[model samples]
Target: MNAKMRNDAYSIFSEAIAAVDPAACIYRSVSKKDNELIISGEKYDLSRYDNIYAIAFGKAAISMSKAIEDVLGDSLSSGLAVTKYGFGNCLSKMQVFESNHPVPDDSSVKAGQMVHDFLEKTQASDLVIFLISGGGSALLTYPRKGITISDIARITDSLMRAGATIDELNTARKHLCSIKGGGLAKMAFPSESVSLILSDVVGDPLDVIASGPTVPDTSSFGDFNEIIERYEIGVTMGIGGLLEDGLEGVIEETPKAGDYIFEKTSHYLVGNNSLALQEAEIRASKLGYNTMVMSSSIVGEAREVAKVLAAITREERHGVSPLPLPACILAGGETTVTMKGNGSGGRCQEAALSFGIETSGLHNVLLLAAGTDGNDGTTDYAGAFADGETLERGKSIQLDAHAYLSDNNSYAYFKETGDLVKTGPTGTNVMDIYIILVDMF
Candidate 1:
């Protein structure tokens, strides 16, 4: 392994993650002065409202809620924060509940109901502040009548395994849940509300982040049907019945543009993939590398993306690309894995394994791909590292890289090679980061 290059890669990635820390993002976006609260240049006179409540959900819920409490201090009239299991922290003025992610469970149902009940206490004179981040759709969910949590989980798993995009997955989720697709905004109607969001989706579409619980949804039941057809997702009888009811107009649609429910509601994008990439670029430059941010909206199959990245690395090495030797390239965005084998690994790990195969025997080239949230796919490792010797290292241990890649078992392969990147649960989510470093001999 090129230890210096590997260290540089980790350093640049950490700087990127720090740039989008949920607490820092919240602090930068919100503040209070006397009896007035200001957020992103909008001022709300606290004296005009009978109460001020803060509600947060997603992986960043706890850290975000803590930041809100610091800004509002004693004026915060209590709050509720729901996060993925093992990501919760104790807060002074808020109650925290840990739930499941990627799939909603019984705890998710309870959190959803709790949020609904909490919002019921809001009145026309109250103000609601919603902190939304990635994974909120699964962490805070209240299934519509006739649909059980099990049904939601089954569908979510199916869509994911089928390699559905975040937009498609969230569109389906918005229809099946009671509180997504602007339902939360409707619940707090008559009470002025503001949502501070940390976007984990490509292009930062407010309507798709956390299934747009507070923002107006551009998609409809028809869109959901199109997604199902595109992915060939098998729908259970109960879910199918609900979809039919939604299509027939027996069930109301989610709030859309120009809806009255959004009259006093505001949504702000506080943190995103671009912000993280910019910081990474700066850090890489400081490390004496010719750095460039490739793109912040990269998406598609993980293995295919890895192939392209490896090709770029070779181009840069040969002076065919813009950056010369000792160059660092960065990209950010989530990728999907079409599960073909019963293996444990996330998109980043899968990408790493594929990149390793494509760049075998190359000198002084390294790749690091990891999720900013510190959890990649279903594994504890955030991602993994790949280099010219990655395959050789595995071969010496009787490990076949091609076999592991074919089985979609990158996690196990990287584990034996000791290249898995583990950072535990980072208190923020901006999506995934990919770093490629090419060094001179």
Candidate 2:
């Protein structure tokens, strides 16, 4: 690939991925006409409900709420949106609450209580529009009856550090939270509710998004206890008492199927990582590169996946006979990194470093990895990118990509080399997008 071709390919792929960003594609999936909102081809009339309210939690909640305002206009009675600090914005009728993410804090605890209170206030004829998306798991934190906010926070931090997948992490959260695992829906029982979901989980499973505040949960408190024990997370005495009491059947289980709460609620998947991946593939094909979306459910440690993708790119570029050339391989999904060093970075940046070092000085190859949510880990940069020249740039600075990887400082390394891809916040959450373009020699 020549310089121009590579740059063109990068631009095409970047825009394609951004096209499905929460800020761009969410409105396409939902629209409002008067008192009615259409979501995913289904029409819902908000006028029928006497008390119309909204509860949005996630990185995309602010933008999603804004979109709702565009449709609902003055009819929005009351609502709440809890997001990370810098991501918060004003909405006419909805109160914006900003809190810590990846780790719960006092602010998250207070906001969660408000969520529970809001749910309790819903009447039978009320319309509860639940805006669900990624990052909500932490944003919507409300500990179970006996558990304290500190207990929940400690467990969450441990699970995250243990490299637990979202599924496993959420399973533990479901058991510890008062509003997760369908508990929020249970609170709004008999009140008509609709969940507008921006899926970040691979395959977009209903039960995993934001820990499924409105979806039915199959896991039990026992399962949650096991996870806590497995991770050896310390909990408060109150939490231990509550768990023991619950295990003894004192507390009623969370709402289940056949419950009135679930009957009155409807869940809709609005957008996901797969959509972003598909869009990227189409754009790559139009740019004259043969493209295939490898998978949207890509998982495992971030570094491992990057190494695997690097090997594949190397094979295809060298044309070991049957492998295709001049192709771009795309993937979307969330990946985790186990933090050991004091360094800072997210999964996408880690993947970039891993790929950068492995494919160093190999011409006709470029790799881009970014989180569609526009924030990777705790950094402002979404992710990073690398071409054949990445290693040379690092070498000039006397920085070893491998050492940075060991310290989980991918973002710092990439930023120094001017390879960090910053998108701020895209307003939509669909996890991460990985792009690899192989050029014919």
Candidate 3:
């Protein structure tokens, strides 16, 4: 391993994560002056009607909520937030509930009910400041009364293991839940609501981030059925009845675009993966490395993406370049993992393992992949790293990288090679980041 180059790679990644800090991003985009709440470019006067409240969810919930608390101060009446377990702290004005991620749990159901009940207490003259980020779909879940947490968890696990895209997973959740797909907006209807969102979805698609709880939704029950059929998942997995009811129009659909409920709501995308990538690029350039923002919306299977990245790195190494020598290539966006084995790993670990094996003998190059949230999938690590020596290190133990990759056991492989990134929870999530360092300097 070129220790200096490897060190630089991680430093650049850290710089990217810092740029997407939810609280800092909120501080930059939101403020209060003379009873006016200025969020992004829109201004809402707090002196207009009555109560002002805030609600937050996702991995960055606490930080975002705190930022809003700082902005609203005495004007804020009360608030609530839901976040992944151990990623939150007690707040003065905001009630924090911890829940599961990548899957919903009982705590998630309670959080949903709590938020709903709180909104029920508001009147037409009230205002809600929604601080939304990623993971809200799971952290803030309230399925129709029939679908239990087990039902949602089973179906979510099925879809995820089947390699369903985030849009597809959220599509299914939106139809089944009463609190997703603009359901929260409906709850806050007649009361003006401002959502300051940090984008975790690529291209910042409003409806897909946290299932677009506070934005107008264009997805429908029909869309949900299409995904279920396409993936052939959760059919008799216990939630089939919910889908049947949805398709038969027996259940009310989630709010759609131009719905009256959205009239009182405004949404602003404060930050996203692009913001993180830009900061990483700046840091890389300052470190004297040519940098390229490869693609901010790259998505596909983890190993497949790794191959493409490795191919690019090989080209750059041999002078058939995309940017130049000593260059860092950065790409942002989340990837999917199809779990066919019993192995433990997240998308970042899977990508790193695959990339490591692919570029095993290529010197002075480092391939790093991690979640901006500092946690990936079900793993404790934020991500994984790979250098030229990654393969040799595995070979020393008679472990074949391809074998581990095949078993979807990237976590074990990286852990044994001591390449796993253990940054713990970063208190924020903007999706996954990919960094490749091709240094000849």
RMSD of each: 0.8, 2.3, 1.2
- Candidate achieving the largest TM-score: 1
TM-score, per-candidate, Cα-based: 0.99, 0.93, 0.98
What TM-score, to 2 decimals, does candidate 1 have? Answer: 0.99
For model 3, how does the per-residue alpha-carbon lDDT over 1-441 read when each residue is reduced to its tens digit?
A: 777887898999999999999999999999889988787767787888689998999999999988888878889888998999999898879988899887999999999999999998889899888989999999989888677888888888999999999999999888778888899999888888888898899789999999989877888878888888888874654467777787899877888888899888888888999999999999999999999999889899998999899999989888898687789999999889998888999998999888888887888889889999988778899889987778899999888888899999999998888889888788888999999999984
Which scores higher on TM-score, 2 or 3? 3
- Separately for all candidates shown, the number of backbone clashes (residues 3 or more apart, or on different chains) is 0, 1, 0
The residue pairs found clashing in candidate 1 are: none
What's the candidate order when arranged by decreasing lDDT?
1, 3, 2
**Model 1 RMSD in angstroms:** 0.8
Instruction: Tell me how many residue pairs clash in candidate 2.
Output: 1
Kindly report which residue stretches of model 1 are placed more than 4 angstroms away from their true locations once superposed. none
**C-alpha-based local distance difference test score of model 1:** 0.94
Clashing pairs in 3: none
Q: Which stretch of 10 consecutive residues in model 2 shows the poorest summed lDDT?
A: 1-10
- Candidate 2 clash pair list: 22-428
Better of 1 and 3 by lDDT: 1
